[model samples]
Target: METDFQTVEQAKSNIQALLKGIVGTRTVAIRDALDQVLAADVLSPIHVPAHDNSAMDGYAFNGAAINPAGMTQLALVGTAYAGRKYEGTVKSGECIRIMTGAVMPEGCDTVVVQENVTVQGDQIHFAPGAVKAGDNRRLKGEDLTQGKPALRAGRILRPADLGLLASLGIPEIQVMRKLRVAFFSTGDELRSLGQVLDEGCVYDSNRYTLYGMLTRLRFVDLIDMGVVHDSPESLEAAMNNAADQADVIITSGGVSVGEADFTKDVMQKLGSVNFWKIAMRPGRPMAFGHITNPNTGNAAFLFGLPGNPVAVMVTFYAFVRDALFKLAGANPTAVPLVKAQLASNVRKRPGRTEFQRVRLERQGSTTVAHLTGAQGSGILRSMSESDGIMVLAHDLGDLQAGSEVEVLPFEGLI
Candidate 1:
């Protein structure tokens, strides 16, 4: 393990270089494939809209029949509704009353909206240049061409993707199998809910926080290993057990340097683990690499995060979240950032990257970021009250009030 701290970008790149998406895949119905990664590209079996159709409730006629400088009149011979077509062909002097989505009559290519025509008995009259040739006509294969790629491999299925598949008449699709992740919190001073707290112990909030975040990722299969006591034997047993069952293992609290930090020792002994002191605030001590169960020959990726509640969340968002998405065979998208003016001056150094909790306030016409008091790693309430995290980049110095900054909103990510 290198004692020198790694930059945030270096740590992310190193982690990604070592990972490959899971290999296993299965076919499932479209309804059940939500948030699942596609194992294969989906091709459209047929053209969408399959035929040339009318896009509005109007009168369909050939454009050449209309007189350019004067009112044009055509006899209305028949009507066409959606899902039904007019049987007869339309001549140059004839038109068909067509509803939205109705198939255009044979020999007719343009549609003048109903509002643009005046009806007199069986005759409909419209002014010249009402609509050009092919106006308001939906052409065959307009939305999707037949035998074309509709969805590509490695794409995560969303609600809109499901609708697209249904439109292509695809009932089921091939997707990567769910990734199993085992997680637990470490520290002898931590206690679970409903347990009696000792004089020196506090209730374990890391596991609950981890649970909420993990649950939001529908593609992940969670294995909550609960809290493991701070002991060499206990840590070893849990690590080996988790490796045998999960593809990835996450632990909070034991990666930091302390007397009871036996997690680092056990991880290094079992696998090729790299302990990294990242150049970032809220989360600095982290461990990344693979751990194996020697007896079963089963190996799993591991993320050893810091002990503080806020640090766990920040590290997970900054590092582990995308790592999990990539390992599960999905092409993850980066979360977007919005610019906001700072509400007050911020005291920041020039080396390490910082993520400060800030409440976004809309004052007058501008949105400003207000600091949520002291930004300590143990302060969880600040995170709860904030709208998003203001990311202060590495090498950025102190900023005066009203200076613009980038913010990562908590709308999609908690």
Candidate 2:
């Protein structure tokens, strides 16, 4: 009997449960940390700014008590700008007109609003004592204290995070290296790009689509192993080499029960094959396994995706890539997903969940998605033309027009 699987969630959970965090590590510059998960906690090395500074383009006073007579005048001392500090101490009854980001001068407690004073040549009048020391002033390490936890482990690095790290003078950071993924397509019916098509031969869309999708997601590096013939030894040799070279292996087709399908047999012999038939259309025959590196005792995980172009693309986004990232020591969860409105009319038969490729149109505060005219798994047009996929529930047999459904946007991920 074969492994009994029924739902996409079940299959995904089963597959993810088998992955352990990869221990490999590498150092990446702060400029290159975007999208990479931090391996260690980032602590603030010093107080941010390292000194006191002004927040507004106002004046700095000796934090003096305001004296409101008919007119009280404080002498205009000097100007302070960012990166340049005023070294002179403010005298009593005197204020310094400052600019934004200017450093606070010694003996200055509060910044009186420039608008509140009347300037007469080098002298200005304060309305009264109305402020305190360090008002609107940014003290050293105010934004981040010394040794505060600025970033924690397992957090994916983003633009803002990188900026903060740079402000802290961190030039380089330690991150889990990107998981090396080896990709191949298995089918005699497929032909490579830039090659003329022969009778009964179709262009190998899966290999390229998978490659593009992986590239868009910012994978560390992808090895294009290309396509392999259906010979058992040829398939085995390809798998063995990839397992030795890459941390994760992904192949489309050859996992199904057909005369030419030898992927499962080789995967099992090379490692451990955990079989399952997911309860979803277009991606029902996905498989997962791990081939132990005989020399190093480390196992290279393999994800067997469907041969259909749309199926391969959707399943890779939903499944294999997450596991690959996990093997590279990235945060296994929190992958991006989007929701769109159902624009076109599409209906599905009961008993299986359907991932329909749909073109999303933004029309007046709503996103409408239309199913690609052709829905055939082998038809690569829908996958190429559509923006993303609209998911139909497993038990939903028919979805009518104008019915609201959830759609995951392609975003930057192809």
Candidate 3:
């Protein structure tokens, strides 16, 4: 059914409400869990350090030995290297030479960094202010306590998370099964990469761009269904096939109210789909809903993005990206936005929100965003040349130079 034009926030909320988590899980080696959503809470099996240890190459001794008014000297008994233990206890007025990560000897509650002390034969001397109690000592269970939850479910595992798991001797982890996504470009004028371009036809760049974006997510099994023509038979067949195999089906073009486009018809015939005109620049026309195969009773979530190159990217990042994350059983993650001064004047209307392509640079102490030439939807180079997107809000009008605006960087997503 046709829905009236809605604001970006409203559209996003609607899409989010319709999403359902995909079920299934699998166990994979920790090395293979990067970018995969964690399926279960991982409780640490043992203390991270297991025992009190030295954080530096130094001497371990009781802090009480330090005299507040003068230098304190302590006799060095023995040495303790990493993986090696000093069996004997440290007595008063005595210290043990300890390497980094070495177990702290009994009766020692502090460490004097090697550089802070002067060695004189069997004695180590340091000023009263050279070290403090409990300094340079890594206490047991400081990093992660035994039987505590180290990592929670629904987190997208990153490099640091893998290191945490490895520190606890965890060899494998439970992760949600990757979401399957089938996508294709629509329009008879769309041509494949190797095919010769006709008079009016252009190469289908949407498919390639979509492929790149999906690949970076790393949690999706991508199926490039090639280019589906603008016909009921072709569109319906493609949608059904995609629905049968994938958890989400994405298509570019054929969504707008064009006389020749049959994408809307095929979508309605298959299942419930809502056509929406979001109040946003670059991408406005969009279709969202679920497509169910009548014969097989299989279904998949749908996202019909705009045909323009930049619009496809903008819409995907603004809407589809988060939806896909939710559908994949990932925890909600907020994309960071930083304020930057505009290097030049920008013309913006008040009603619809705008995503202007901008290249950021350091202007003295303040970061500034310069417009990437023309802001045309068909100009894909604008996106390539830009470092981030400057979000001009719906209530904001034309902005002058040096005005502060929020910019969403392309750091993690690119």
Candidate 4:
């Protein structure tokens, strides 16, 4: 009945080390690559803005013709629009009317914005100090150069990356394959939705929340195996079935030190699973390891999260989230943390880290964090009303009002 305790940092390191192998890769169209991790470096095939072009709709002229101390007037030669070029050369004392994105004409090195110039007949007049040499011009290869790396491997593709690839005339790109994740809740007291709930039983909400969290990742193939009973036969059957189809298996209950729970025994019998008491509040008991499929002998990573609604989310966000990203071939990314002043006093222990749900308020230029109602492991409403979690470190004892602490917002991942 003894528990093996590990600090938060140590547990994270252990979990990451277990999932070091990268997933396989596949080719996908740029449009279909959003949120997928890049498998190889993307090199630009050609220079962006292949020719020197105008960045503004203005007059293009030789910069050397401008008088330094007084106004200068130049005769307008011709007009140039985007996709159209002025074949004639611009000499001193001559200018060409140009539109935005138009290729710079021959011998033109500067552009005076139209608002800064006055036109009378064929003459355009502008102050000498209104424009400078090489003003309002986009040079060739300024945004991206040919044969240079535009995006590195292991980068998660965003919407803008697709546009960047389209700009480079790349229709498709290489990206890591989607991760396969199978999850289920365990407990005889749990029931699926639309089922009549008997005494001492409740409809399972863990699977729904897990589904939402996995769906937001956008690159996970989720297998919702419903709820498994707390019996040796039932738990082992579920694990074997999940291991055959998934790279990772997530279970929401039966990880705590309870006599009725058979998940720990079944996991240990099937693979090299470890049950640990992590030094963290709300999510203390967890099981992590690799489980082998008895049918096919293939192995899959296992994450046994606590049953409490908030604990399941917190443990997944703090540990399993990053591990899955690494296994899916994504570059290491840290969750963004921002410092905020505490609106009230907080009490804590010295040995365990605590994650308190809080609401963020903007008081002038400072961000202030206030607790969201009650801080309980089973309180699902607190998470819904909270903007983020205020992390109280292990070495920290207590915090006074107006003290600053780190908070991880639920912006990028909800």
TM-score per prediction, in order, is 0.96, 0.86, 0.97, 0.95
List candidate 1 stretches off by more than 4 Å.
1-3, 259-261
What is the Cα-based lDDT of residue 296 in candidate 4? 93
lDDT of 3 by residue, 332-365 (tens): 8878897899998999988888999999999789
Please identify which of the two predictions, 2 or 3, would achieve the higher TM-score against the true structure. 3
Point out the higher-scoring one by TM-score: 1 or 4. 1
Highest lDDT: which candidate?
3
Q: Rank by lDDT, descending?
A: 3, 1, 4, 2
Candidate 1 lowest-lDDT run of ten: 255-264
Candidate 3's error at 377, in angstroms?
1.1
Candidate 1 whole-model C-alpha lDDT, 0 to 1: 0.91
Estimate the overall C-alpha local distance difference test score of candidate 3.
Answer: 0.92
What's model 1's TM-score?
0.96
Specify the poorest-scoring 10-residue window by lDDT in model 2.
63-72
**lDDT (C-alpha, whole model) for all candidates:** 0.91, 0.77, 0.92, 0.90
Clashing pairs in 4: none
Q: Show where candidate 2 strays beyond 4 Å.
A: 1-3, 62-75, 91-93, 106-118, 122-135, 194-196, 259-261, 293-298, 332-336, 349-351, 395-397, 412-414
Ten-residue region with minimum lDDT total, candidate 4 = 1-10
Per-residue accuracy of model 2 over 364-395 as CA lDDT, tens digit each: 88778888887887778887788777878778
Clashes of 3: 0
Candidate 1 residue 21 Cα shift, in angstroms, is: 0.7
